[model samples]
Target: MESIINTKILVVMTILALSTGLGSCKIVQFIFGDSLSDVGNNKYLSKSLANANLPWYGIDFGNGMPNGRFTNGRTVADIIGDKMGLPRPPAFLDPSLTEDIILENGVNYASGGGGILNDTGNLFIQKFSLDKQIELFQGTQELIRSKIGAKAAEKFFNGSNYVVALGSNDFINNYLLPVYRDSWTYTDSSFVAYLMDTLGGQLKLLYNLGARQVTVFGLGPMGCIPLQRVLSTTGDCQEKTNNLALSFNRAGQKLVNDLSKSLKNSSIKFGDAYEVVAGVINDPAKFGFNNSDSPCCSFGQIRPALTCIPASTLCEDRSKYVFWDEYHPSDKANEMIANEIIRKLGFLYVNGTNTPPPAPAPTHAHAHAPSPGS
Candidate 1:
């Protein structure tokens, strides 16, 4: 495990070296996912209800103000970028974005409420779906070609890093919503299978588009999120939801491995978000946190205000809280999660020196779902 992690570090160190005048390799990041990964695209979705362009959100970022992130500070995506020495990819909808900027800094297509399936975030009404994100990426590919020519564009994209942080919203907003037919149309495992099949196709599309080094983040402990906990009378993590997430993550790790092998010259890594975040929630103090159940910024009596508005009550010290709101983590929690992700994945080379060999895939592909009572 350490060897693989070291290989990852080596890969990123190559980029860090380049960034510091040791080399001229251009390394930039492309980010995609739901709100947890969103930098500011949600702000551009004028009609979307699920947004974080409000008070207390991004309260610790660059200028200590909301910058379109859902949490009180940087999202996990932003923290990961910071850890890798790569500039945080600007939101794809940023009006000032240019083709040159993309070639230099890449772009973030992650928006609040985005999901793998096009229909997953329908209630949001104006969010990007994974397909839409890919479509925009394709458009970015064309935009760059117009500026730097096809060969140069291909080289840029091939060497750039791709970060895909999806799936959580697909379950949280769609499959679990009775308003959506998916909840009724498929059983838990079958739904996960459907998501995996779609994600497999999506990864293939990215490979075809010239992504060689990619890291796909798995869903964290969805059942343990504040929103899920509030659903239980005892305020415990929902076992069924947690089981569903475990099943999906198991499949996701397998998919990442299969794609790494099947796609020539590609190295895809799965970020084990579930275990790492679960560890934090299970024992917050072990990770410098004191509270993992209640959200730091909230307004409702039950906790998880859906959104943290100016009217919400704020925690005395966000650093002690695990969750920022109902759905996202506090900045401190994000940082911890980010560090763990980097430690585990080992490498991300938006533009680097060498590609490491694919790490061994996990042997287990499915977690046993608990029977009726147990």
Candidate 2:
């Protein structure tokens, strides 16, 4: 009777351990990028032009609060988190939150106006450079280890998903602007190559810091932005700008592919957001987008100097528009882009290992949940 009782206790302990290990397998998502992925980091910067603290920003979020997200609703990162069965990562600057927030899913280090280069621009002077974001990601990983354990943390990151969306500001706001265009004396090709080198170094840095799976988004068509259109002749997309974006995308693709080969055991996937976005612009109706060239907000004879605001005439239906403003995509557009990213991630995440279980359905209600797009 004593031996049997001891065996039962051992069985209970084993079951507890197994349950703990299984629960620890929660997948963490680390997002790094610019305005496209920024949740609320821009709000931390006082007097920063990158601020998104306004109503129009989160009109579809139901909260009716901006949250410093530069969109009519959730961005691609939010969709990725939803698809991964994790909550949208809280901003690193949210003082109300604790490390537990990060351990549950992950942390978002993305900030609007952030770029690969430290000396990028003036909009958000205090924004985290790509290198700094990666460091924060490392810190988050350490926190996860403390909360869970080293082995669990390792497993979490080993099978984790990393999404990086950036590079538009580097070209549109920094390199191409007259202030630096003459000062830097860099042609489009040289600028792209420089960006590629720096970004590749950053990817390698993340890899060394335990990022085994990474998805890098290439540059989108910046020429078609309302800001660019207003600045160009004929009020159309500047061919030169589009060419630069394409060049950057091509180079970025090569960089990600080469990095995968160099890293050997690591899996790095490149999402062709450039091509996908360009497709929507080139063929809008096919993707359920109505206006692809012009922004849905602040339309008409407004000059590039004007900003999209409440006073501006917003489109009646944001879902039909690809771009919400000058530099950001609408929620509908972001959902499409996010879906494409997930498809690519599926290939990378399930490449050599057993497929991860499908993410459970979301518990909380989202105002503008992601819908299927081409």
Candidate 3:
């Protein structure tokens, strides 16, 4: 009788533990955005103006093979996917990927120099804009429906998390570009309003497509980048560019909050990238970084006038630097940002109450480890 009672007690404990401990259950992540989130889509596009599949780009990655990632190693997308128990999805443009694989695992449609508007990244003629990425996502939805039936596809869409980390290029590559100078036509506030309107509509379209959990990342401090700093006469961060980024982040935050309330079943959070990155930049030492202003792999006196090239000087300790090139963050910087963002994401997904678990956890099925009682 006692043996049977103990057996029953053990079973009950196991059930309780499993229910509470299986935290990172969601595995599929549908990522969309610009170069910050891009893995390798630009590699397949010959006409892409922002190519990174070259020396000094992936110098820190395994075997130093440039895998089309803009940074010296993994991007924030790759790190976040790791923490979420998700396998890094292949770029949609990867010719070797099959339809079956894409349906089973989500596809990454982010492109280098991509933006919210079709004309935003026009300098990169081959870049896929937000509208184009969404259209491709719709195609992905249909493919899933055709293969697994409508009900199954709907379930998958609802279960998966949608991530959008775009809009930076809309300002940097379009509004600020001398050739385009879209900002010249309107005040900063007006430009921000226009971007918000378009972005809100695109987000609504995504909700209509069945994304119950969506995370939208706001713009970082673009003015602090080496490229922007080099352009300033005083060699300091341009106040105008900084203001534009701030305006965009503020608008994005409000948009995400409004969408979360209106969508009813959806949970959307605006990743305050400006705040997170600003903190790191203000005190690089706190984040184990020695230099925040200079590029780790670019030429010139901290403020390089060109992109990282094959002959560019490389930093001995990549972790000591914050920026990898004139435009992007170092792999270590990305790792720090990814860790902080994942914690924020964990809190968002867990009903906004608890602190998130630590990083470097196992991936995929291993994340769903058995409970102690079991």
Candidate 4:
């Protein structure tokens, strides 16, 4: 484990070395995954039970308005967009926007409760799986082609970065939930292997769809969160859940390494989110946080059994709390995590050292054709 951690640090250092000094490049972003990246995709789904389009969900947003993001404010995708000097990409499901406007900048296809596997978030009732998000992105490809022609669309997508952050729900909502728990049939290691394998194919699909720059966020310490703490009589971190999360994160690192090598003309960065959040959890004060184990928007009590709801008490100062609700991080915490990710992914080709070579110009064999008149 120490060796792997060291290797990950080395990889980050190498990327930092390569990405230093580059002034700017035209890098658009298309985010995928679950609630962690969902700007408002779940809000547009009629049957979606996993939605944050309610009070306190976006209390810290620009105007204190809930926009269906799971956090109290901007998500990691939104933060990255800010860092990249771009506005938060619109949700692909937003009916208020036109296809042309949605494709003007990349669109976010993330949905709360989404996972790498189709069956992972069945409890959500309606949520796009990673496969479905990719399919939606494929649809955007058609719109882009229609607007700018196929060749220009190819250049557009190749320059764009795809941010994917899912899989926590696969464990928290599926493997750990009583109704869908897989522990009876599969061990922790086996379950993580299943997730990694499924994700590998999904990543390949993005590559096929012209995504050459991608970032995958590793899972954090699930056992330390409030919801899991409430389940334990002792109210301490659940070691089993922590171990499972660590196992998945380690394997995810390996998956990123393998994909980086296999996919030519691509830049794949594994965001060490586990490390970042674990640091904040271990010493909340270090990150200017007062609470790490409890949710800030719980039902009046510090350790309330019920999580944030419409009537739940809100924190006086959300910035001091690491967690906003039971399962999601606060806006402040998301900002910290985003900063950590940007530190690693921020300068993605600073001096052209180890920079990914430009993707080959698109042809009929490159980007798949859109439907009739698409």
Candidate topping lDDT: 1
TM-score of each: 0.86, 0.84, 0.84, 0.83
Q: Pick the candidate with the highest TM-score.
A: 1
In angstroms, the error of model 2 at 351 is 16
For candidate 1, give the lDDT of residue 302. Answer: 47
lDDT of 2 by residue, 205-287 (tens): 88877788788887678898878887887888888989988998888889988999999688888777667888888899998
lDDT tens per residue, model 3, 1-374: 99999999999987764433122233467889888888789989999888887776665665565778888778887777665656577898988766566654578999999999888888887898999999999998887777667876787788787889888898889988768867588678888998899999999999899988888887778898878887888777777888899999888889898988888799998876577787888898887888888787766564464567765767767778888888898878887777777766663332223343343311221122122223
Clashing pairs in 3: none
lDDT of 4 by residue, 1-374 (tens): 99999999999887764342121234557889898889898988989888888776666565555788887777876766665555357888887656445544568899998998888889889999999998888888887677667876787788777889998889888888768757467778889999899999989889988999888998889898888888899988898888888998899889999999999998888887778898899899987888898887877655553335676766666778888888888878887887888897664332223534332111121122222222
Q: Rank order by TM-score, top first?
A: 1, 2, 3, 4
- What does the lDDT come to for candidate 4? 0.77
Worst 10 residues of 4 by lDDT: 360-369
In candidate 1, which residue ranges exceed 4 Å CA deviation?
A: 1-24, 300-303, 348-374
RMSD for each of the candidates: 12.0, 5.5, 9.3, 15.0
Error of 1 at 257 (Å): 0.7
Candidate 3 weakest lDDT stretch, 10 residues: 361-370
Q: Whole-model lDDT for model 2 versus the true structure? A: 0.74
